[model samples]
Target: MNQLPEDPCMQEIQRLRADYEAKRARSNLDSAGDRRCIRLADIPGTISGDILRLKQNLPDSVDHGDHEIIGDKVRPILNPPPPPELDDDSEELDTILASLPIVDVDSSKRFVKKGKYKSEIRNLLECEG
Candidate 1:
């Protein structure tokens, strides 16, 4: 009678395959990671739940872990701070205007030549630099 050989390599491969299968199964079921999110049983939290369920599940070579629940509950949409609050942009404008230093305008106009305007601007830029 010929006895089948117990290959260590095959045994190791089987062990790894089993381990992967187990983790994949666990990932599909378990979602209680960091945050406690309300999971819908009907819906799959993961995109590839079906693939994971299949016997030929892809190998976890890419270190692709299951996405954990982000939040405890879905927040209710608030009726965004009254419409008036949004419409009242004048307050912001007023605040900006108030922050600006008041400048006094001299009614007297000393007309400088058009050519002088460029020189004056260049001089002002040079001074600033």
Candidate 2:
């Protein structure tokens, strides 16, 4: 069979195709450690209805010993506790105010004249109010 020579452009394209296939195969092999098959059902909190269904199916008499313990440990991480409440009697506010830089009398007078000192004091106590 007399086969005509392959076109240079077609030869170049075939070579590129082979290179691309090799790279794709290597990429798939390299990504084997990744959770490539993870679905919505596999992720926690992704399907709230399924969780509710599971909870409903479980009998009240059954002890969820390990599950409860795991949930307790995970809950704080998912929903962190609110910061400690600052009351009017809290000394933290006083401590913060005391930590402010102390200016000399002349600068303090200038700040007072421009109402900058009062504004700064008000800003420091704004969160408390």
Local distance difference test values of all predictions, in order: 0.39, 0.38
TM-scores for every predicted model: 0.21, 0.21
Candidate 2 Cα RMSD (Å): 25.5
Poorest stretch of ten by lDDT in candidate 1: 65-74
In the range 5-116, model 1's lDDT, one tens digit per residue, is 3766656766777787676775534433432222222224443343334433223331233222222222322332322324432222443344335555432222233222
Please write out the lDDT profile of model 2 over residues 27-119, one tens digit for every residue. 322333422211112234433233232321222222221121122121113333444567554233454556556655543112343332545
TM-score of 2: 0.21
Clashes of 1: 0
lDDT score of residue 102 within candidate 2: 65
What is the Å distance of residue 119 in model 1 from its true position? 78
Off by over 4 Å in 2: 1-5, 29-129
